[model samples]
Target: MTYTRSEFPDTFLFGLSASDPGDEALTEGFDSFRFPVHWQQVLPRGRGEPDSGGLDHYKHLIDTVLRRGLRPCAILDSSTLPDAIADLGGWRNRDSANWFAHFAETVIEHIGDRLFSAGPAARSWTVGKSDHLGTDLRAHARSLHHHLLATGHAIRAMRSYGMTNLGVEFQLDEPEANTALHAYFHGEYTKDYLAKFSPNLPKNWQRDFDSIDEPIDWCALNYAHFKDLDGSLPWSSLHREDTGETPLYVVADLGSVENTENLLGDIRSDLAQGAPIKGLFAQAQEGECLGLLQTALSGGKQPAPWVAPTKALHGHWNMVADVGGTNTRLGVVTNGHLDELHKFPTGSLEDFQAALRRVRDAVGTDPQAVVAAGAGPLRDGVIQLTNASLTLSRDTLASSTGAQRTFVINDFTAAAWSVADIKAKDVAVLQGSGSPPPGTRLVVGPGTGLGVGALLYSEGHYHTVSGEGGHMGLSPRHRDEVDVFDAARRIAPECFFADSLAIEAEMFLSGTGLPILYQAVCMAGGQSDTPTLSAKDILQAAQSGADEFAVKTARMFTEHLGAITGDLAVALIPVGGVFLLGGVADKNRWLFGQEFLDAFNAGGRFDDIRGGLNLYVSEMDEFGIVGANNFCKNALAR
Candidate 1:
């Protein structure tokens, strides 16, 4: 059967390796091109400043690819080290890693935005033919080890420059011959290098390797020749599954028309047998081979860019739910206005599906779309509540509510989305002057658990990014705080999940954390006979000034909250505003006074930036619901 490109998955990328940008016809039928950028050519000396002429040449080539509506995959050639660096022992030179990292950073800063994918260097650095290095096994091992190290450094540098979609290239050989060699190669690149050759590796090399987290996002396999198809296909599939790396298969060295057809046939057979191939590429060094591969790939079209799925609301009747740890708030949006709001204890329901069913019954109308924000980590369209024994999923929400589409987002993400609709009356300002400018906004609060999310504005639309900022390690500032923190570490060891005496922000900032903080305060004051008080009791006592321990606990909690919020604000630079939400903040607005403001604006060098930030305590109890409604409207409009 003659196979067509239509048979492959829509997201599967098909492209070729090209050096000449002037040859526009070379990329006519391809969606991507693998452009090899030689380090020796760009940096010549492999140190100091990069050559402007060489940099512009590659930049122009990348620009041409983008101009022609094709994605460019750049591969930095590590094999061709600059003459100066090679003289100093090339990859074997320990300092060469830093030089390569610098080069990677420079290249990424210049053209990272335009490229679809990038690699620190060609894959041959790790798995190339080892015969060229002679009989010195230690030298050969060190060279290979340093290459991997340099690649790791380069990957980190590229990521720092905001380059995502990074990858690595590997050459695939015969299955039997590859199995053992590939294992050794993979082990060295991953976590097992030090175990195998600790003596040969550089001092403290394990620490450096440990710092790298799953360096590459994808792997490009160079498929040249495989005699045993049955043996090779399964091995390749197993390798991809084991490494958890997306595989992009490239048929290397296309010679004749017959050879190209045979390779294509092999690819078709692999696809038919369920090979996990995410992309396909053809390597044609010569003009004739390029023409042959192009003709063979005729009728193939570039896949459209992937966009997150959203359901358009047919009318104004949309359902929104804020699934908090203690209570669940459900509301209906009519013509962009929220109405028919209902509240119920979250613990009373079995799961989110039952809650959705109750809302549907109360409203007597099926929602066009449903957006449920939960207080937990969202994974695979589901959330397992951190404080409550409840689970929510998009499928369950859709089935129960009879909505065309459903969204499961973090509770803080919902709060961040609400920032666009916040009014002057609903906000109580604590810092800065007038209204905040249009940029990034941060919404963080302490409730059952500390929630953190950011709203980023780009292309005239707001995008929400959620994070587990509450788990960040908290440090004491003064002597009193240090004493309380140390006491808490001894009294409540369960709250410290990390190293000894390491207290997480949520361990003292959330509603659940308040009771622990109060107990710690009593212990620090050498009063161990005090009764264990609930978070509510402590808050009431503190508000009435009846208990000094409770007041101290409240004060410590707000101070830590300010410090953590300030740290996050500095890191995120939420220029729009820093919003404080959740029940604890709403109920205890008086606690967030001068001390909280002082703590927030306490950055040593960044004091001016922190002081200039607009801080607001959101009094709106339906902030999450309103945010959900806004999110639903925006999604539907999109």
Candidate 2:
């Protein structure tokens, strides 16, 4: 006689051990169990091309479990992949990202009505070692990027097939899950640090899944032990050595408990001071652990403190765009990491939509959001490009890129946010630097024109402050500067003249301004043989030391820039940090040595104010795109 689901109680027993179906699980008195549906078993080739012989094997296994009154929860992949895809560089390859999606779609198509919940992947963590996902990266940031790429792809693909119940299972303290920044985000990094840290998750693997907005039917913690050296156990032991300053404690006991009293106490301690704990799950054997938890939960008198996890932006790809007058730079941002940077010439593209289409095609998926930083002020959610024949608006941007959320901001505003998540290699310190002192950080640059903004750090949040500060008065200090300012007032084209004898700071500092300074220096020095040079030519000549007039022109520019920087330091009082950005600072970085420092620190009575400020030159070209991405992330999280 064949057994069936009706023969046993609704809560019958079963557990899956390796590939042996549910026979041992049934013997162990477990009601429900999960099993792996290896991708290699279904489509040995990794693509949609199916191997019929391999497909039938998994179908028979599922049918066998059902016949024995066992509930089958299918985990689509145990990080398994076909050899073909693994050979092609696995998850690191953009093409392989879709492999998980294809495999998920195929699995759901075959077992659409059978699964209790369709789980596409398990333990979706990345590190430097070669793992089941076949991705290898020494950097913690890169691993996370590809990890999200694969997860997002599979999630979108599975949902497209109409499978309602989907979830992701994760292990919190897995050894490989704790890489440099990976460990830092998980409330663990250096044990010898001076701060008594807490169990707060600055970053979590769950966010990648949550961002997709796919409902999690269940979360299975692979191993329930929390007493290991790296585990979140004994709650009190999980902290850095205390600094002289008192640190806010955030640790909690996340271990499996036996009785109801201890369990309630453990949870209440975590919620003692409004620290958020979304949900608690027990992963012990069914009798003592499950019964006590069920009884305690059922008999609760007052409502339990229920705090949900951090809500994330929707699970679509996020695109960041930095739009200049001549060209636009676009890249896809996932989990705060940017990749696949591509350039689009605005001259060729008919409109913003044309540029967006090229970006969308390059990404090969619809973006959830697009954060754009354009070289114009954003007014009423729209911006008219200063150098191009395009107007960017949120409404049109969303329609063009198929992004659910769209944000357009001033280019300088975007530059301010880029500093928040800057990499070490991206920054080149010019003067007075260790770590940034805590306060407001300033970003001012000269490209087509002078751009100015500040990043305010208050209450653990970043606020971008920007205005028409670029048009501040240019006060001449030295004789050369006085001559240059006077010459700029006279020879300045009619377009640059604001009023009688009023020379704005940008007239001697910006890309266009650099040439004006060179011509003024030629006039002041009476060098009649000096050829008329463009800003680019002057910069090149100065860098090569080929033209003395060009060298003096560059020097006069820096001296004025340094003095203006000192003035801004006095007004804004950004003791935290100061960033010099754009092509002007980066191209002639050689000029920022002693002469520039001397001029910057020449703030007379307030010389200490400018001298103490940490200064950095941003070498990144697409810093605006980075800022826009962060702006979108923060805005959405809010």
Candidate 3:
């Protein structure tokens, strides 16, 4: 059973499993080990005095490990449930999450320095089918929900507590299954089944139960021998079943020297098959476990920091996409920068799947991760495009594009990404004289629809506030605008609803609103000869000075946009500046002429505020795509 630093492959690992509370498992044999601290054992009384005996036990264990130049991998919580908290409805009660977070922080405050990564709760606690009776499914599901929330809170606390090296644990209940139903506990089948099983919890809570699918750090796989009388299945039957391919994985815990060698052999087979085996870990009471993985660690090579948990499976390449009403743009990114760009009409394809394939084909590259921004509302990782037939789902898109992970964000949010570090020359000055100030910035664009978002700089990072600001009520400028608003409401009542005597702005300032405004203007002027035209036609006719109705329509759209811009400036104050995007703003620079500026600057009592605000029209052809790429980079880096 004696192994050395020269016998095993380079990408192997050794670790111990702290099954009990004592330091007996802390002996020298592994590079790392998972030590579980019972909640009640440490606190004894939930929130009372610290158990001195308990504290001394863990301190001695960690100090001994550190003295031996070993890494003590602490597991904050495993199967241990404190009796005090359990009496108070442990995990089921909403307050239990906070209590658990407090415990995690306390541990980090004490022995965090000697640890390889922050101690997070075990995988068995957050995911897996309940071992309790089926009738208690509701409580069990609720417990999972609270544990996930607490996990997120603990991860954030760990980052804030200066624990950069972190790992999240996940393992298939039974790795060998023909379908995803039994293969992975984290799947739609399991989620929907659980939802049906527990209808008592809030619908929204059940719906978003799986939102935390992947962790922010590395994913640790805890595997043990599945055969023999002590284990569940017989070894002959287990080996007969295909466990499928695990391209990139981290082997965390194994018991015996035989199991360690077998798992290492499996990793070696994966490597031979041209599949990546990221790393491995061996766990045992003896030093032989570490000796077995010593050769693997002695190679002095380490896994890349970019490697992520389950979803962000690969660290080599990523993709960024902007799915808008009219166009679908894509690009390949490397090291947080755009490497290639491709574009296609949004409606030219049936759905996001075909569109992604087309873009990938044109670019001639396969990305492991994709960050797509679309113009629609996103729920449960799916987006229903506001103006197109495409429905982009994060899971579906990932499956279609051969990406291990995918993220879908609002299209406006993506466009706002470009505003973070925009140069002066890229924008045409629409109003004001100086550069943007030092506060938040706003990006409002009108195309198929009005897109609105704001950017704020905080904690040395740019945070985007994406919302439906475009649908807010509109305020008319003059008596003529009153008649115009009435006419607009008469034409398209859906766009103009008087809530407390305030009308919606999107129906008057967007591309779809332009045609409606043209019809309204014709009616106001009593010109029956004016023909119905599209927003684009109206703009062309107005620019040619051929149709008076068209001219009026263009004027109305421009002025309304300017008015909304002014209102947004006062509302969000975007001291950084207001960025104008979309085809409408980029195409009609003339429409935003003196009259539009007049309407924008005419803030009445707040005219000084408008006068001090900088206004610029964005001319970036790939603003959203660039933003998407930047967003993926920032997300991965974080």
Candidate 3 on 1-638: residue-level lDDT in tens?
33343444454445556555245655544455556776666787666566888877888877666655556667676355677777777777766666776676666656565566654643433222223424566665566566665665565455434455664554444321112212122423354545464475435764443433333445444454422213322222222342223323343445555655665665555555554344454454446544556554554543222211222111245778888777777787766777777777877345557877876554443465799898887688778888888787787666667564688888888888877778777888877644555558899999778889888877668887888877888766667766666676766776655543356667767888777778878877887665777888989999999998888778777777888888887887777889899888888788878888887888989988898888899877688888887777777665
TM-score of each: 0.50, 0.53, 0.54
For model 2, the superposed segments whose C-alpha errors exceed 4 Å read 1-315, 348-351, 361-365, 423-425, 493-500, 527-530, 543-545
Of 2 and 3, the candidate ranking higher by lDDT: 3
**Clashing residue pairs found in predicted model 1:** none
Candidate 2 per-residue lDDT, tens place, 1-638, comes to: 12222322232222332354544333323333366787788888888677787678777777766665545566666365578876776554556556677787777666745665556543444331247323222233334444444555566565544455565544435544322222322323345321322232224534443333333444333333443334223322222221111121111122333333353454355445332332343343344444444444343232322221232112246888888888888887776778668787766335657878877766555676788888777799888887787787898777787665789898888888878766557778877765565678888898788888888888877888866567787766765466656666666746344664446778778997777778777877776555777888988888899999888888778887887877787788786678899888877788688888888888888888788888888887678887888888888776
Which structure is stronger by lDDT: 1 or 2?
A: 1
Give candidate 3 regions above 4 Å deviation. Answer: 1-238, 241-315, 347-350, 357-368, 379-381, 402-405, 433-438, 498-503
Displacement of the residue 60 alpha carbon in candidate 1, Å: 60
Q: Each prediction's Cα lDDT score?
A: 0.72, 0.62, 0.64
User: Which residue pairs in model 3 clash with each other?
Assistant: 5-295, 29-287, 29-290
- Which candidate has the highest lDDT of all? 1
| All candidates: CA RMSD (Å) | 15.4, 20.4, 11.5
lDDT of 3 at 148: 60
1 versus 3: better TM-score goes to: 3
